[model samples]
Target chain A: MMEFINFYLIPGLVLGSIYALGAIGITLTFSILRFANFAHGETMLLGVYITYSLVQFSGVHPLIALPFGALLTVIVVLGIDRAFYKPFRNSPTIMVVIASFGMMLMVRSMVQFIWGVQLKGMTQGIQRPMIFFDSLRISPKHITIIGAAIVLMLAVHYLLSRTKIGKAMRAMSDSPELAKLTGIDTEKVVRMTWIVGGALATAAGVFLAIDTHIDTNMGFKMLLPMFAAAILGGIGRPFGAVAGGLVIGIVEEISSYPWIGVEPLLNPGYKAGVAFAIMIGMLLWRPSGLFKGKVF
Target chain B: MSNSELQTVLELDQIIGGYGDTQILHGVSMRVDPGEIVVIIGPNGAGKSTAMKAVFGLLNLSGGKVRLNGEDITNMPPDQVVHHGVCYVPQTSNIFPSLTVEENLEMGAFVRTDDFRPRLQELYDIFPPLAEKRRQAAGTLSGGQRQMVAMAKAMMLEPQILLLDEPTAGLSPKYRGEIFAIVKTVNATGTPILMVEQNAKQALKIANRGYVLVDGKNKFEGSGHDLLEDAEVAEMFLGGGAPP
Candidate 1:
């Protein structure tokens, strides 16, 4: 049990926190914009690279450098939205979806060109885990990631529930035509969606980087699981996305947990398959998902 | 009455519009004077709702003018139209399904920078059922209650004029009568109402004046009482029966 907690459960939760953050952006964009934003993973990658450069230059902790990275990422995302996605706002959703796919390639190439496809570490040396109760182990960085994720999640909850603009955002998501009739500025709501999505994507990328090394493909690799998380939680529900993320994360880790014997139950090599299976199963059975989100 | 008091609050002049080259409203014109309930009663495809959309700028107008307080607001988008003190409750999908009733009202006052709590309270007082279910999702309400939520949402802005497109379209007889009473109560508060109603008799009973539209043109325009008593209107529109 101690080995499972230390080796599988703790790592799964750390990964889940990162996925939950990234999935929030995916779910928001899918809901409000009414499009599958294929370029979202690239946005996360861009934030990670920016954070990497900031840490290298200022010698600050990744957490300290995260806000700057997120801000810069937001600027870049807003620019991309204006240049590529804005023209397709009134066009068919497919047009914007294809545009996002093109953007994914363009952004990935740009990151490779600037960062040279090299693996970079956000922190210099690895610190050992802090043992609690002589058997369980928890890393200080993991604690920080989980704590920060909780704070951000609470902030998002407050924004969506309490603030005027947040309420307008929810209103727009619920019914865009009624929202327009009610005098809510659609463009302003769209802009706010991007800002929130971009910031959360940056936080997700930074958290992942703190856990593992950053590479050009890191965001792309995590993209599938994050999408699975979003779909599992429900297309537009932020809280559902968090729950889906945690479930996917824990399941992926536990799938290889040697539950039957000591031979590694599913041979950790195929862990990514778990998310895909769950996602496909959800799409087949419950397209509205656990939170009863929008079907489309 | 003084000249300013008699001024029209909302005027639709020679409005011609429709979706994608199929013209619906052909030179439709209507007006709502201050402190009046104006109903436009017409058969299907007579462009009654289209005229309302024209006033709200929900469609493209090839020719016409919408004036609010004598200011030309022709072809203004729906969001901008709300700022000009004209609120419209659509026939269907008027309330955000997922938003709570109070949140729907909040979005109604999205343009206002000042406090709207008093107006909200006033609306709650007018629509008592909505006040009890203020926190419930608007979609979960019955058809009649949803219509109440829709009207209350439009009233949140306290507009100079209110346009309701078939407010009681799908309600039962009991709820429909209740809605008519609610309309009269709302009108008593001095907000001029321009409504398109299928229940022509009940609507005209509450309306100060009414218009009879046929094929997108005004067939008749008179005081509600006069129109109700008109022999031809009674034969064609009032179900071929004597005036009740």
Candidate 2:
């Protein structure tokens, strides 16, 4: 029993951390842009591709590739905002959502055409496990994923609370028109939000690639679970996303076990189904999410 | 007012403007000299706010020009108007709700590259209640406090002129007095002020000059006391529920 607990629970915790990080980016983008970005998954995939290239050609350590991946994603997101999002600044919300879909399809096709549809593992090669207790081990990949999530979350907290631009972003999120009259440069703050959100999603994608295999459609596959975490946590609540991710991750992993089911034929592959189930439950009970404040 | 001593801070000359396709201000002309308090009062839909918005570059002026000190800024955007030393405090939804009072003030000085700590201190000193609640979120404050923050934030740039659109709208009678008192204090400190208010009777009491607007035209213009005491002006625009 203890062996099972250590193996599944600990692994779920690590996976949850990555989902939380990705959801934070999604929620942040949603708040600032006032629309759901269906294209965020592609942005994450772009990060993974960048990290993969670094590891393939330069022989950079997978851990070192994390920050590089974040930086690259920031550039990509900012460029996309300048080219795509800024043009529709005053357009309707439905128009922007459609534009985001267009962006998603464009990025997805680009990734498939460039990288091809194949699962690629880390080139640097992951090491064996580092033991934590008797019959319990913690891998370096898990440590990196968990550690980076903590550090990045803390960094984001500090930036929002301490920095001037960060405060401006929060103010804009609360009330955009008011932010403008108060002399907050709405344009600059919007740019910074996209940059920061893209960076975090990129970091999460790289971490995810290290833990599993990298593929062009990996972000697309993670979308349902990522959104489930965001909505379940509360649409624009950051800390709620973190907490929701862990809950979803643990529930998905635990329910996938055949022993828990009435019908023993059910496989662990049903984990995806579990995310939808949890999401439906959340929607039925609380439409505004678990922590109700502001969704848009 | 002396010709040389009358330092014009903001000049809107025969300006014609509206939202789109509809003209609200038909040849509206107004001015504010340095250290003077000018008030524009009228019934609802008299184009008073529209005229102020044209000066702030918020509306598309179809004709005439807006100038600061002597330079033409007829077609400039609202954001650029701030750089030209024109600060406008809108009637509603003016301060960021979720931000702290201090943070909102910081954003008010967004265009400033130099340190604004001294300016912030000065503002806090000017608004002592805000000083005690500097860290509190602006949304959490009372309606009066929010108005105070909005006014103080606009004042952060220390612009040569301040434009206010119905600063005392929807406030309690007590808050109306408080807002007027603050406006007087703000104007006494060298910045010229041009305000539109629904509270005409009270507004003219503090105003140096008053303009009575009716149906997008300047119906009456004179010293505040003269307009206040004019029975014809009072019967026409003040409170009879009919246009004379």
Candidate 3:
């Protein structure tokens, strides 16, 4: 039981936090901009590589390079929005979707062109784990991932509930025409959405790279889990994505353990399958998602 | 004839426009003054709502200009209309359905930089039902309550002139009466209004003046009682009933 708690539960929580960070971006983009934003995973990949380069240039720790990387990612994604997505905003929905898929490929190839295809570890050494209560061990990297996710989520919550721009974003999401009638500056709100979504995606990438490995394929690999979590929780719900991410992460980890009589039927390799299963279950039971979010 | 040109709060002078090249409102002109309720009644496709939209700058106008007070505000975007002390309450999608009643009110004052508390208090006092359910989502409210919320939100801006498109649309008779009573009380606060209403007979009762529009043209313009009593106006539009 002790081994199970330490190995599966703690690790699951870390993985869940990473997934939550990514899904928040997805949900916000879907809500404010009204698109699936398939390039979100690639955006995270760009963030991780930027953090890697920042760490190398400044010789700073991954944790220290995080904010800079996130800020740069925000700038990059905002530029991307202005260049590519803004022009086609009023176009057909499927056109924007196809554009995003193309953008996903575009971003992936850019990372490959610059950083090459080799996998890279964020930190130099095999860092020691921090010991908690009896037989409970966790790494500093995992602790950072969990802490960062919590802090970012709290900041986002405060922004959404207590700020004017946040209120405008929600209002626009509810009804764009009504929002315009109410005198909300829709363009400013759109730019703010990109900033928030970009920063969250960056944090997700940086933490993910630190915990596992940094590579061009990192974001692509996370695509299924992040999207599944977003869909399962609620397409346009930020907090719901957090809940969905934790569920997917824990399920994926626990399914790999020998819980049912000795040997486990599901392997850790079936982590992707766990996300698919949960997403399908949510779709079957409540298509609006757990929080009654936007169905599309 | 009701309010002179200088006293008029809003004037739509020979307004002509529609979606794309199809003109819905042709040479439709109307005006409302300070502290007056001017109601527009017409058939389903008679451009009553289009006139309101053109005045509120929801779409482009092919001809004619809208004057607020005395300033020409022709074809200004909807966002800028509220700044000129004019606000619009859409017939539908009036309130942010998912937002709480309080949030809807807050959004109503979105463009204002000054304090909104004074007007908010006044609105709550006027609509005590809204005040009691301030935390409830506007979507969850009954049809009458939702109309009240919509009216209350537009009132939050404290506009000198309020433009309403079918405020009592699709409401029960009891709710309709309640909305008219509220509208009467709202007009008492020095705000003039131009509204399109479906219940022609009931709406004209409280209206200071009324316009009968047919095919986007003004068929009859008279004092509320005169139009209510005019045989031709009644036979053609008001369903041949006594003004109740």
Of the candidates shown, which would achieve the greatest lDDT relative to the real structure?
Answer: 1
Winner on DockQ (2 vs 3): 3
User: Per-residue alpha-carbon lDDT of model 1 for B31-137, expressed as tens digits?
Assistant: 88998999999889999998898888889999988889899999999988999989999999999898899998988899999999999999999999999999999
lDDT of 1: 0.91
Candidate 2, residue B154: Cα displacement in angstroms equals 1.1
Residue-by-residue lDDT tens digits, candidate 1, A1-296: 99999999989998888889999999999999999998899999999999889988999989999999999999999999899899999899999999999999999999999999878888879889999999989999999999999999999999999999888888888888888888999889999999999999999999998999888998788889999999999998999999999999999999999899678899898999999999999999998889998888
- Give candidate 2 misplaced runs (Cα > 4 Å): A1-5, A123-127, A133-136, A257-267, A277-287, A291-293, B1-6, B240-244
Q: Please, what are the lDDT tens digits per residue for candidate 2 over residues A11-46? A: 788878878888888777777778788898889998
Candidate 1 displacement at residue A150 in angstroms: 0.5
What Cα-based lDDT does every candidate model obtain?
A: 0.91, 0.83, 0.88
Order by lDDT, highest first: 1, 3, 2
Runs in model 3 with CA error above 4 Å?
none
- Pairs that collide in candidate 2 are none
Winner on lDDT (1 vs 3)? 1
Q: Which candidate number would show the highest DockQ if scored against the true structure?
A: 1
List iRMS for all predictions.
0.8, 1.7, 0.9
DockQ of 2: 0.50
